[model samples]
Target: MLKLHDYWRSSAAYRVRIALNLKGLSYESHSHDLRSNAHHDPAYKALNPQGLVPALDIGGHVLTQSSAIMEWLEETCPEPPLLPPAAADRAAVRAMAALIACDIHPLNNLRVLRELKNDWQADETQTKMWAKGWIAEGFTALETLVGQHGKGYSFGSEPTLADCYLVPQVFSAQRFGVSLDPYPNIRAVNERCDDHPAFVRAHPRHQPDADTVDSNH
Candidate 1:
């Protein structure tokens, strides 16, 4: 059986959950409380050297990193493709995914925010501002890209990897109080995804280890 080491609020884990749901794969989720340092446990580190929220144990192999796990799933199970068929189309999807996962998300990850408070002595307000600033910059550009390439979803009429990445970033952004009104197209796509079973089931609040949060976000 496949097992997923997950944190409810983790955006990367959220991406994988969506992918698994889309692929019709069943996985046993092992919840980790990130706020309580459960992710740093030695046993968890053996599975993931980086001690990340998501580490997949499957078929006698432990896979680290969310993107790598998604790619592996894509290769092993090619039923409903998360990536488009065409080379250029796939590249476009990856580019958008990278914009969120690489460019925006890394800057505002939990570790980075924690470091800001612990190492740099940044207050809550400063950390919040930092996160919003980075997300706004990336989201503004993504808005234009989506406006040009999207219809009801981030890449096209159907959900793609771009949508998987986009939804989580929006979740994290809203958690930190980043406004989405500037990107009407993005918001519309987010709304559409919110109604999707794959996205809905993968939402943080829907997880077994979900902590209380404002439902309005």
Candidate 2:
């Protein structure tokens, strides 16, 4: 069986879980509690020098980075494609994915928030505002793009790599209390994903390591 190093609430891991579920591939989950610094353990560090979550152990090799793993899955398991067939459509979907994975998520992720609080001396309110600012900015741009490109899902009728990146970022935006009302297209896509079996299965709340207590970090 495949082994996936994961943390329940990690957005990166969440994206991979969605991809795995969408492809109907099964994997074993290994939880490392980020709150308790378990990701910094020497063993996990040995597995991934960066000590990031969502490392996929596929027999002889381990894959790190959610984007890379999803691409690998697409290459290996091409039955239910995550990308559109047309080259331009594929690039458009990838652009949407990068908007979230690169522009939005990185600015508001746990590590950046921690840096804001610890090093920058930002209070909770300020840190939340910081996250909200970036999320709102990214979503504003994404709304326009999705409005133009999306059919039912982010890129088309079927869920694509764009949706894989989007659902988690939407979750993060909600966690930071970013308002969704202004982005109807994004909201519509999220609503559609809410009913998707793959997305339902990948939700952080359903993970084995999920905590009953809510934590923003």
Candidate 3:
């Protein structure tokens, strides 16, 4: 059986959930309370040296990183494909996914927030602003890409890897008061994607651990 170690509100983990649902794969959910620092526990560290949530223990072969896991899922199970068949189109989708995962999310993740508190002594408001700023900037660029190049979804008419990355970022943007009205194309795609059952089940509010907190998503 597949087991997914995830945090309820983690955008990275949320991406994996969407991918899993898109593939129609059933997995056991293990919720990690990131705020409690459970991911830093020594035993969990043994599973993933990075101590990140959304680690997949598939038949005891551990996998970490959301993008890596999503790609692995696509390769291991190709039905209802999440990526385009052509190599160039696949590269384009990967590029859009990376724009969010690599260029945007890393700068504003939980570790970065912890650093802002511990090292920089930033208050909660300032930390949130930092996150919002980065997200807004990234979304601005993504907005252009989606507006000019997008058909119905981020990369094409069908939901692809880019859509998986985009939806979570949209969730985060709404959380931090990032006004998305400026990005009409992104908002439109997000609305369309959220209508899917896969996206609905992957929502932070619908997660098992979400009841533990008064989640706004």
Candidate 4:
């Protein structure tokens, strides 16, 4: 059986979960408690040298990186396709996905936030500000892209890879208090996709590891 090593709140891992559900593939989920530093354990490190939450063990062939995994799934499954048919359409979808994964998310990943607190002495407030700032910048560009080019969706009327990546990043933006008012297109696309069962099930609160979060929040 396929197994996914993941954290419930990690957006990167969330992307993979959505992709897996979209394919309608049954898989086991192995929770890694990020707050407890379980990702750094020697056993987990052996699986992912980067100590990241999303490491997919596909019948002994380990796959790292969420974007690559999503693309691989699209290629291998090829039903309910996550990409568009035209080359230009596919490129546009990929461009939107990269705006979040490469430009915005990398700067605000778990390790980066931890380093800011540990090495730079940034308080929680400051760290949160940093996260919001980058997300806003990225969203501004994406909003424009969607507003000008999007047709009821990020690329077109159908949900594609862009929608999969967009919804999760928006979820993180909301977590850090990034206002969604400025990105109507993104919010609209997110709202439409959120109604789908695959997306609903992929939400952080619904994951197997979700119970680990403190109830106080």
The backbone clash count of each candidate, in order, is: 0, 0, 0, 0
Off by over 4 Å in 2: none
Candidate 4 clashing pairs?
none
The predicted structure with the larger lDDT, 1 or 2, is 2
Give the whole-model CA lDDT for all candidates, comma-separated.
0.91, 0.93, 0.90, 0.86
Ranking by TM-score: 2, 1, 3, 4
Q: 68-147 in candidate 3: lDDT tens per residue?
A: 99989999999899999999889888888999998889978888888998999998899889988888888888998887
Candidate with maximal TM-score = 2
In Å, residue 183's CA in model 3 sits off its true spot by 0.6
Off by over 4 Å in 4: 212-217
Clashing pairs in 2: none
Candidate 4, residues 113-152, lDDT tens digits: the string is 9899999999989999999999989999999888766787
Determine the backbone clash count of candidate 1.
0
> For every model shown, what is its TM-score relative to the native structure?
0.96, 0.98, 0.95, 0.94
Model 3, global lDDT: 0.90
**Per-residue lDDT of model 1, residues 114-194, tens digit only:** 999999999989999999999999999999999989989998899988998999999999889988999999999999999
* Of 1 and 2, the candidate ranking higher by TM-score: 2
